[model samples]
Target: MAWAGLQTALQLIYPPRCLTCGGMVESDFGLCGPCWRDTPFIGGLVCDLCGTPLPGVDDGVPVHCDSCMTTERPWQQGRAALMYRDSGRRLVLSLKHGDRHDVVRPAAKWMAHSARPLLREDTLIAPIPLHWSRMARRRFNQSALLADALARETGRTSCPDLLIRANRTRSLEGLTRNERFATLMGSIRAHPKRTALMEGRSILLVDDVMTSGATLAAATEACYASRAREVCVIALTRVANES
Candidate 1:
């Protein structure tokens, strides 16, 4: 396998060092046992609608957050691995800026394990698209990489061009929630040629980090607009308690 060979070569040169503690490790993902265990894995009392961890599963509030209650998301449902803590932040940063594509496997494996029951043979896995300029600048889309990893792990087909970013907007950092939503509205659209395949099909939208749910909401709207029956989002991490 190419990844195995690559891992071998990388180990031979740089050796494996844990991302959390910088300790020697056998794997190429830069994670040590203690750090891996310390990584916050989201479980228990999760929302039925968006799958963000809820305070109680059967508290009888119907498992929707304040944001979900106020705003309608076109996606059918969604789930994320962990809250946006330091560990998740470091993992995403490594994948995005440190070129640590190796993290995709472990991250996507966890996502796939959680998403298996939600996926079907006919389900289409797609990644949230980056603007062309952003993709060119980064030379890769972290979402696409995650989608590919999920597809390989789950035996699903990943359609890279299904969803597209129509326009590039300013970063949402430091922006108010309303401003973020306004800037994100209609920023994504289904690729014209792939519109036919979208109708009446279930899609799993893959993203690395979700904040304010703005980007996922916009992508879900575009998918629904393309006539998709159901869209479910899966992300590595999400901003917790953003109500």
Candidate 2:
């Protein structure tokens, strides 16, 4: 009843709008008709390794992206909720840079849905850490926001500090694959306090986006170093362009 009243009060005070189109929304997270039809829900047969769409397949062959086939990934498996396209990029930017807290719930709900099949019953969820300098400026970490949203829906505890950013790296927008990996190699360190909790635990590594898989791999190495038995990766969006 209290939660219902809170929702009602919020709705009365602030008319909800579709996050994508800015059209009037009847209920919270209810997308406008156009947006609903247009939103790219990632479904169908996807890469068994990274969850990206594949053009051709052979049964018994391990499904993975060309990138994953060439380079080793520290995390056991990775899944993305959406491809890095207009709608996917915009949604992440809105919640991340724009500080749209309301978008977190729907975004996280979608992530949780995609991850449900892969999630272990006794898994520990952890978000990628932001460098202290970056967190200080943004006043929040987008990965932490996504993790919190998932925890609420899944009834799991989110440990945000399982990995800590040891140093800040340059923006990876234009970096080469080798360069990105080199930059991320020692950037993350496992937290000493949570060292015991990580041992033998199935860990789900959460992040807002996955570009080169470099960052997540580095973080997973840290978790593994701390004795985590298994580490899986989940990201909201992933860069799909090969070139």
Candidate 3:
């Protein structure tokens, strides 16, 4: 009962606040009702390959989105927690650029839910790596943080340095699909020292956001090159429509 009393006293001094809006909430790492409703959490029927929301009901069958149907996704399957818009966009920006480490916990829980179908008993969780130069500028890789938290949540092993950027590439922000793919091709590879860990193992690649999926494709190919049995991917958010 002492712990409970201490918790209550702490709450009085520092009440839990919503992750997105900073409003008083019943618990930490959660959103208030209005923010929760506004957040575009992907649910219901979703694409098997990319987790884009679909129109039909989920009938225990996997389906693909139009983009995924045409695009060549190297990973066996993929999922995402949110569409890159509205509250979802805000949350991603906060975590990615604003140094909001507190967002990682709840975000990992959501990613874990989306990744249920892609997980396995021996799955290895790894994050899409940033170039050393970029990592130096950012001081932390948000995807790595999310991947580590997700591994803890799912009881899986995480390797933050499983993949390494082979060369620095330009930002893909304004690039077309083909441009993005070309830029990232051969730019990522498995870390030499860590390649043995991926031998015949199923790997789950984690990323903060996926736009054209070029980065994910590069990471997936690296896993395959290292002889991983299978690879899947999950992102915090996805750009549903490239506009």
Instruction: Give the Cα-based TM-score of candidate 1 against the true structure.
Output: 0.88
C-alpha-based local distance difference test score of model 3? 0.95
Clashing pairs in model 1? 19-30
lDDT of 1 by residue, 92-187 (tens): 888899998878888988889767546876789999999999999999999999999899999989998898999999998888768888999989
Q: What is the lDDT for 56 in model 2?
A: 66
Lowest lDDT 10-residue stretch of candidate 3 = 234-243
Candidate 1 lowest-lDDT run of ten: 54-63
Ranking by TM-score: 3, 2, 1
- Compute each candidate's TM-score over C-alphas: 0.88, 0.92, 0.98
Best candidate, lDDT: 3
User: Which lDDT value does model 2 have at 221?
Assistant: 94
Candidate 2's TM-score reads: 0.92
User: Each candidate: what lDDT?
Assistant: 0.84, 0.83, 0.95
lDDT of 3 by residue, 38-113 (tens): 9999999998888899999999899999998899888999999999999999999999899999999999999999
List of clashing residue pairs for candidate 3: none
> Whose TM-score is greatest here?
3
